[model samples]
Target chain A: MTSSTERSERAGAPAFALPFRVGRALAFHELRERTRDRWVIVISALFALLASAVGLYGRSAEGNAAAITGPSLVTLASLFVPLVALALGYDAIVGERERNTLGLLLSMPVGRTEVIVGKFVGRALALCLAVGLGLGAAMLAAAPGEARTLAALLGPTMALGLAFVSVGLLVSTLVSRQSTAASVVVAIWFLFVFFYDLGLLAILVATEGAIGDELVSSLVVGNPTGLYRVSLLASLGGENALTDLGLDVSLPSASARGAIWCAWIFGPLALSAAALSRRALR
Target chain B: MQRLTLEDVAVRFGRIEALRGTSLELRAGEVFLLAGPNGAGKSTLIRVLLGLVAPTRGTLRVDGAPVRADRAFRARLGYLPESVAFSESSTGREVVSFFAAARGAPKKRIDEVLERVGLADARSRLVRGYSRGMRQRLGLAVALVAPCELLVLDEPTGGLDQDALTLLWSVLDEHRAAGCVVLLASHEIALLESRVDRLGLLARGQLVALGDPTSLRERAALPVRVKVAPRADADRDALVQALERVGTIAPVRGARALELDVQPSRLLELLDLDAAHRACIADLQIVPPPFDEVYRRLLSEAA
Candidate 1:
C-alpha cells in the first residue's frame, strides 16, 4: 500500500530538535566558524596585543595596575571593542544567506530564534574570550592588584561590544546584501562611537552651553555607544571629561550607568532577534 | 511512511505569482521527479515542501495534517538546496559533524553517512579545497544523515560526477525502499526517466502534466519509433522495403538502417525477422520519446 496507510501504522513519532541543545550547538558552531574570519582573528589578536602592551608599559612606567588600564585604557577600549563587535557580527544573518548556508542551517529542526540567539551566544563567547585573552594578558603582565579595576573595565566594554554585535545582527536582517550591512555597520559605528559626541559638542557650542544637565544626560544615554562611553566613566575613568566636553553636570553614577549598559546590551539584541524570527526564510 | 499532499497551494511574491493553485500528491515509496524550465516555479514549490516558503493560499498537508515550519515538523524532513556551500575552512568531517548536531542526529551517523557519500577519505580535507563533485557529495551526506519522513532535493544531481551520482541514486533508492516520499526538482530528471515513478511538469506556475513515463508519453501524444538495422553491407533499400509493408519508412539518422513510425502494438511483429526479411535486417530497435522531449513538448503545449 501507499503512504497514508503506512503512516497510520507507524510505531512512533520522530524526535524534535530541543531548543537548548540546538541553540548551544549552533552557538559553538558559529564560534568555531567565526574563528576562521580574518577580521575576527585580527581584532582578537589586536585586542590581546594592545592590552598586554598597555599593561606592561603601565607596569614599567608607573608600577601600578590601576594606572595601566585606567582612563586611557577605558578610552581606547571604548574606541576598539565596538569595532570588534561590528567587524565580527555585521554579516551574521545575511552572510549565511549569501553563502547559501542559511537554508541549510535553517532547514534543520532549529528555529529562527535559535539561530539568532545561538549566534549571539557564540559571538558573545568569542567576544569574552578575545577580551579576556587579549586584555587578560595585559592585566597579568601588570601587578595582580589592578584585577578589580580591569574586571570593572572589561564588563562594560564587553556589554558595549555585545550592543554593537546585536546592532550588526539587526542590520544583517534589515538588509539582503552583505556590502549594505557592512556599510551600515561602519556608518553606525562612526556616527555613534566617534561622531555623535562631536555632533553633540557642536550643538553645545552653537547653543552657548544652554544644553542643560538633564538634556546632556538623556542625550548621552540615547546612543548605544554613548551609553557605553558613560558606562566607561563608572568603570575606571573619572566623570570630569563629560563636564569639560560641556556637559555642565556630574557624570552618571555607577548604578545609573549600569542600568543604561543593561539597556544597551539587551535592547538591540532583543530587537534583532525579533526581526530575525519574523523575517521569512525565502 | 509520509504522504505529501498540496491542495491548491499558491505563492505570490508581490506582483508575481510564483506558484498558482495546484493540487498534487506524492505518495510514499515513489521517486517523484519535478521538472520545469527556468523561472517555472519548480524551486518555489520545492521550498514550500521544505517549509522554507509558506504558501500565500491553500494547504500543504503531510499525512493529512496541515504543518508549519517548526522544529518538530522540520525534523521529519531532509532538504538539499540547489546552491550547496559550507565554511571554507572547516574540514569535511567538521562540516558534517556541525550539521549533524544542528540536525539533532546521533554522532554515530557521522561515520555511516560519510561512508555512504564516499567522503571517508576526504573527511579530513577542508571544504575549501574540495572539488565540485566532492562538495556535492558532502551536501548529499548532510541530507542523508537524518531520518526523514520526506526527502526534498532541489537540483540534487547537479554537479555530481558519475561515481557520486551513482552513490546518490543508491542512497535515494534506499530512502524510497523505507517507504518515505522522495520529491526532487531537477531539469536533469530525464537522465533517470526509468527510475522516476512520476514526473511533474510545471510551467507558468501551473502543473502542466503529472504521470509515469508511459502515461506521459500517452498524454504527450507523440509517436514511437521503430528502427530496422541491416546486416553489414546489406541493401538498405531491402530493409526499407521490408519495413514499408508495415508502415512508411525513413532512413535512421546517420545509420545504415530504416526507421518507421509503427504502432507500438505492431513493433513486435516488425521485429520478427523471418527468412524473407532476415537476409536484409540484422536487428530491430524500438525507440520511444524520452522524458526530455516529452518535457519540452509538455511545456510548449502548456504555454
Candidate 2:
C-alpha cells in the first residue's frame, strides 16, 4: 500500500508554487480585513482633506495652484506618507501575535517569509490606494494641468510609504509587545522626518563647512524621507532644490535614487522575514 | 503520514526544561489523548509536534524520513489551538475561506466546513459578535476546512457547549473513520477516556505512562468499586461475610446495597462469591477506577 505521505505528496501542489499561492491568500485576507475595518476609507479621507488644504494654501500663497500644489504636495507627502505607513504597519505582525493569530497563521502550510511578504504587500497596497484616492482627487481638482507632476509625486510618495512599512514590519517582527513596536515606530518617525535633518544641520553648522558637499549629499540620502523629498524635487525639474535651499548638495541620478528606494523597501522586509523564520512561535 | 515519530525530543526555555527526552510514535487511525495537570508540558509537547518549537535535542520523522514543518509537510496536518482567535473584522465564512485557501483546499470546502461546524446560519456574521462557543466552532471549521493525515487539537473543548461538543465528537469520529491520526491534549479525561485509543500521561516534562485505558487501569492497580444490591429477604450478613474475605466493605448505604473496594486482580474472587450467593444478590456492578483518578495517580507517581 502506498504510504499516506506518498499519497499526500502526490495530491499536494508543487513545492515552488506553494509560497506565492499562500502569500496571495494571506494578502487578500489582510486587505479584506483592513477594508472591512474602514481603515482604507478613514485614511483616504484624511489624506484627501490634508491634500486639499495644502492645495488651498498653495493657491493663496503662490497665485498659481498648478505650479505650487505639485511640489507642495510632495513636501506634504514626505511627512504624512511615512506617518500613515507607520500607523498602518506598526501592528501588522505584532498585533497578530498579541491577538493570538500569528501562531495560527504560521501553523498553516505557509512559510514565515511568505507571511511577512504577504502582510507587507497588503498594507502597502492599502496605503497606495489611500494615497492615490486622497491625493489624486485633490490634485486633479486643484491643479488640472499638473498631471505629470502629480504622477511624478505619487511614485515617490508610495515608495516612501513602502520603505516605512518595511521598517514598521521589521519593528513588529523584532519586538514581542505591540506597545513597544508602536513606541519604536513613533521614535523612528521622529528621527527620520523631524530630528534627522535637524541633527544633520547641527553637524553642518558645528563643522562650519568642514563637511564637504559629497558627505552632505550622502547624509541626506541616508534618510529615506530626505531621499524622497530630493527625488521628488528633482523629478519635478528642480535639481537644485535641496542644494540651493538647504545646503550645498548634489542629488544622485534618478535611477540611482530609484534603486535606493527599492533598497529601502526590501532591505528591512528581508530582515523581518529572516528574524521571523528563526523566531519561536509559542 | 503513516507513522510520525518524535525520537527523544527535548525542549528548554532558558533554564526551564519544558520537555525532556520525550519520545512517541503516532500511527494512522488512532486517537491518542494526552492528559496532565497544569505546567505538565502538555502544550509544550503539542507545540513541539506542530514544529512551532524546535526541540533542543530530537528529530521528527514521517514514515522514517526526517522532515521539517515545511509547507508541503504541514499541508498534511490541521491544528486547533487552545485559544482560537481570528480577525474580528472578518465574517465566519471569510475566515474559513482564508484558511482553506492557505491549505489549498477547494473553495467549495469553505461552505462545507462552515455547515459542518454549524456556522452556516451565521456565516456572514463578523466574528466580534460571536460568543466564545461560536468562536470555538469557527476555529473547528478552520481546522476542518481541508482534509489531512493528522489532526492536532489543544484544549479544543474549552468554551464549547453541549451541542458544539457533540459536533466536535462527530467531526473527530469522521476524521478517525477516515484513518487520520488524531492527537489531542485535554483535561477532560472522563469525556475523552472512552473515545481515546491510547492515553499518554505527561508529568514534569516526561512521558510517565502510555497505553490503552484498560492497560493503564491495570498498571495503576487501583481498587475497583463493586456494588451489590441484595433482595429484601436475602441474607445481608452472609453476603457481607463472604465479601469481607476478599475486599474491604464500606459502611454506607445500609441494608439496601453492599459496596466494597476490591483489587482488580481479585475481581474474579468477588464474582465467584456473587455466583455462590446468587439467591441473595439481585444486582452486581463492577466499576473500575475513574480515568481522572488514574491520571492523577500516575502523575503523582511520576512526581
lDDT of 1 by residue, B42-80 (tens): 988877776678789989776788766566667677888
Clashing pairs in model 2, backbone N/Cα/C closer than 3 A: none
Q: Give per-model TM-scores.
A: 0.91, 0.90
The DockQ of predicted model 1 stands at 0.46
Native-contact fraction for each model? Answer: 0.59, 0.59
DockQ of each two-chain model: 0.46, 0.45
Q: Which residues of candidate 2, in runs, are more than 4 Å off?
A: A1-19, A38-41, A57-62, A65-67, A205-213, B227-245, B249-259, B271-285
lDDT of 2 by residue, A90-163 (tens): 88899988887787788777778999999998888888887887678656656455555566677778889999
Q: What would the DockQ be for model 2? A: 0.45
Encode model 1's per-residue lDDT on A41-153: one tens digit a residue. Answer: 89778877887788777777865554445655666677778888888788888988898878777777777777889888888887877767766777787657776777666
